[model samples]
Target chain A: MRIYIYRRFERFWHWMQALLVMLLMLTGFEVHGSYTFFGYENAVHYHQIFAIAYLILVVFAIFWHLVTGEWRQYLPTLQNIRAQLDYYLFGIFRNAPHPTRKTALSKLNPLQRIVYFGFKVLVIPVMGLSGILYLFYRYPQQYETLPFGFVGIKSIAYWHTAGAFVLVAFLIAHLYLITTGTTIFSNLKAMITGYEEVTDHHPTSDSQKQEEVVI
Target chain B: MKRIFLGLLLLGIFAAILIPSLFKEPYRPPLLSQLREKYHKKASKSADHSKFLPLQKPFTRPQEVTEACISCHNQRHIEVMKSSHWNWERLEYVTGKGIRAIGKKNILNNFCIGIASNEAACNKCHIGFGFKDASFDFQNPLNVDCLSCHDLSNTYLKASGGAGMPDPSVNLNIVAQSVGRPTRNNCGTCHFFGGGGNNVKHGDLEMALFDTEREIDVHMGTDGVDLSCVDCHTAKNHQMLGKVYSLSSMNRDRVQCEQCHTDKPHQQTILNRHGIKVACQTCHIPTYAKVNPTKMEWDWSTAGNLKNGEPYEEKDSLGMVAYTSLKGTFTWARNVKPEYLWFNGTATHVLLGEPINPTQVVKINELFGSYRDPEAKIIPVKIHRAVQPYDKKYNYLVQPKTYSVTKGDSGFWNDFDWQKAIQAGMQHLGLPYSGDYGFVKTEMTWPINHMVAPKSQALSCVECHSRENSRLAALTDFYLPARDRNYWIDHIGKGLIIFTIIAVILHTLLRIYHSTKNQARRDV
Candidate 1:
């Protein structure tokens, strides 16, 4: 059976965010002088531009999540969490069944919920706030910057770079987890077409089975 | 609905970048009117002294002009006497005692040491007449030099050691008639040439200031504002507005940018906020000694070195005098980036009789301020380093007679005898100088406040925040990000991150082994 897992708005937000985040990391690391690709000045310029766009996307995505009642999909639970962890670790390698089923109401498994929840609630907010502060730290007007605040530029830069590394680590892990689906391309295809396949004899309700064709 | 939100966001981003321009064009009065008012006010206030019958005489002595000027302006001579230019002694308050009088006359500087035995050569910049020896009259009002401050003819040439009077060949009648308001040339004559020649003392101030472009100095640009010396430094009763490092006056509020500008001089709020702790000069004057090279290092120990039977000199790549047998060895540089420091108006001077530490480099004049001081701001400075003669036996810096070229004079340059020069200098100052002398390392600091570049040329954010070759690399008081790193914290953080990944991988391998056994049993 095939099931519609992600809405159009959700798919749009996901792909746009991924693209912007990649662009931000590229330009941001250049600004940090990690390895210069675009020159330092150009890197800073592009990073600021992408950051503003990412902020706009975040606001719209937040609104969409709230209106569609999709925020609950990330609400974590301990029930079957260990089973899910076992499935990812031991069960999948031994050709065992997945611990939890995917539905319109539950897009993420237990561990996914915890990781994504922390990213959205903690890491993303931290990155956004710190990036904003760094942008305006030397807000130049009439060729002079505003005096420094209580927090120095160094503190702001450290927090922003730390957040970026967290995001980078999450991205690497997210990439690896995509290949652990029913088929290597199954999760990727679902994100693109909004339809994910299930085993033929999977015990899904008639109403739940019919939900795949709605989109 | 989503499309509408995206459209609104795009509009907001555009507004964010565009709104600043609308508020940027600040309302400044037309520069034409400001210039006219400034020059007109200065020109109209001075009574035409040229028409006065008392001044129309062939003055043989420069003192006669002073005498004639004081005849009409009775209290002018009295006011001039109290100024640092005339007295060469400032009311020292940096130590907070306020009782001591300290100035160039008594301060032991790195460039030329002290003015004790070298008064004839040093006092070419002095503002009086016939101050040849200790018995020179300070109370005589006729000795006040009016022409040095108000020479409009620009032809008045003060012979280097001619006791504060212009050379006899320079017609005093013409000079007396041409006296008017002080221009840049009038003040820069001594200031730009201090420590010997142009670009010697203050790196930011040089002959380049006379007709430099806007890129060199925005305020004093020849093609732009063309401001004279009196424009910002408006004098009242012969006392100039700005304080000098040599004078060590704490009256910093006498003149500032606030005279013509508002506190909120920026269009952006953040820049205005930065204005509180960062001085205007910090950003504006990015580099000093832009056009002409300024002397940075002077090694007096190398003086009296001769290649053969005659004195020899060496030149650097830029043709600047590098070494000379007469004086010392010097190193010069142009477009030099100034060292940053925390400066709170006051500069501490090492007085003439102060004790010396031979083991360490002595600061001839130390500029004191720190990040913790509220009154202090980060400012740019030119650090002039040197090796000078000091009395090793007395544990004090020695003053050597430098430029008395007379046959019988005991000047070091006149006849290369350190003992005679030291004896002559000690006798003149009436201070004890032990016969033994040795070279001691010394440094002098001058705060850079001129040669302001345009706004576009100001330092960028990354200049001072980089890992290598950062402008503030030498600054150790506070840790700067990107430039400074805590190794332990970084290592520990990375170690935890690595440990987490390793633990995850190990736990998964163990789970796989257990699950394979269970699957094998189920299949059997």
Candidate 2:
């Protein structure tokens, strides 16, 4: 059974992105005066700079995904989703079997593929655009021109604040599911050093599925 | 390898943000200071150009220059002081009229009629030694002396340690708020900007506050004469004072714009990129210049010029005449919009707005001493009064308004009760009076119904009844009533250290809590 469907680069990007996002969310809220860890102004400046870097990384990731054709793997499908949900809910707890197999080509669990794809294409982009708009959302001193009189300042501030709320919600969900990985640190270590082992009893790869004589 | 690279990238980022910033102190936070005591005092105190007030510091000025004009243009100073121009000085204000406060030093002199605090006000009518002084830093210096051209001699100090008269032949000053010069920089000293790299915020005064050819935010910038700021904003040494017999009650316009703009064309209705019809002054409204109008505060040195035994009439050698008339009349139009007029009584940071219509009127029953009220008048009574935040003079400002005071021998309350006074003032002004500012103050009503009433008046007992916008000076945010900033900074540092220790303890507790909770759940 194949053990490495997630490439070294993809795993590296995933965990690096996760850690940075956690740091960012923690610091970003502190900056907004929600709470304070670092001083408020310092947190704000750090959040802004890190946000800029994250945006640059997104650009790089998007280009990499496009070049690698890995983008196609996340195209949403209803196929096998119901069965996959049932396998995790009942079969896996009963020790019957995992309904899905990990392969060199398809590494993501069905739920993760759909959710991650949605986040990358929709949620993150909204956060990025709204945050960028917020940073420069000030009236030019020389021009002093504004689209909306005073409302312009307030509106952008609202949008950025709303986006931050959404991002924070996502972080809470992501952190709570750390136990879902094969072992406590297995998924985390795979992201860092780029490898994870699979037991023979579990169906490990689609190549093995293809080699099955009857199916 | 990737983690190593990530570490290097983080290091690079830290260096980018920290190193240069540390060296240059590039991270200067916005100055959180609002107008404080030193500034408030400066704004409240004004220079007496008309009277002989001692200069704050020694600089070159001629005492006798304008003496000749007193003979020819008698009473020019007195007349000028009564005008809207003198409004900066709060002349004729029952407490103070016409005058408003801007910065303590940078008094926004309303030189142009029909245009409040516009560029022409700065470069045209307002004149001083800086216009001729080569060393003046136009950006910061409150250089324009109110008396520059008004003096009969038309005298000015020259760079070469010489005092010379403006060419008497020249007719400086705008020709009565009419058609004049069109060339750019005409009012650029406060408006048109771009001279000497003197950037302007809005389209009010040009770059220079005084002669700032470069910029208002910067003082002492470098620029050449070919690009001289005065090219368009040409002021004539007209040797005259404010407009006579106008409600405005300030100096006649100075710095003739016609020399450059020979033609007069009003608004040709057209739309700009924003799809709004335009006028040259629409975006360039005079409000910018007028916002902090400081020119009107009375120079304490010239406060009460009493000529007790003499008659009210005085004549200058020029066959000019003057009177001690205290009648203040005003017209409401484009330039003379409703605004607060601070009196030279006491300097306070508080702002009190005027109503479009003043609810009362007062006549000069007498000047220079004991007088009687000829008739009953509505007065504004104080309801509630509070001291200014972080009083700069750091002295007690006892407001005997909302709170109480003992009356002499009269067991009954004082007849001039503050609560009654404000109610009466509010009633007269047709305003719903509430709030208990005690000291009673009122205003004589104006002629018209201004839409934005409370937004435009002087600080009165009745007006401050409502509270809004809780702001504090920057100093108050930190520990203060202490010595210099260093001690306060140390206090903040200690707070940070305590906070860090608490954070570590809290984090350890949280980790323990979560782990135990997880184990209990698993056991169950």
For model 1 the local lDDT of residue B313 reads 87
Q: TM-score winner among the candidates?
A: 1
**Alpha-carbon runs more than 4 Å astray in model 2:** A140-151, A201-215, B1-524
Q: What is the lDDT of residue A5 in candidate 2?
A: 45
Error of 1 at B482 (Å): 3.6
Instruction: State the fraction of real interface contacts model 1 keeps.
Output: 0.07
- lDDT by residue (A116-149, candidate 2, tens digit) is 7887777777677767765545333223556543
Candidate 2, which CAPRI tier? incorrect
lDDT of 1 by residue, B37-126 (tens): 554344453577678888997788888999889888899998999888888886667654355788767777778777887877788788
Q: In lDDT terms, how accurate is model 2?
A: 0.35
Candidate 1, residue B188: how far the Cα is off, in Å: 1.7
TM-score of chain B of each: 0.88, 0.21
Interface RMSD of each: 5.7, 16.2
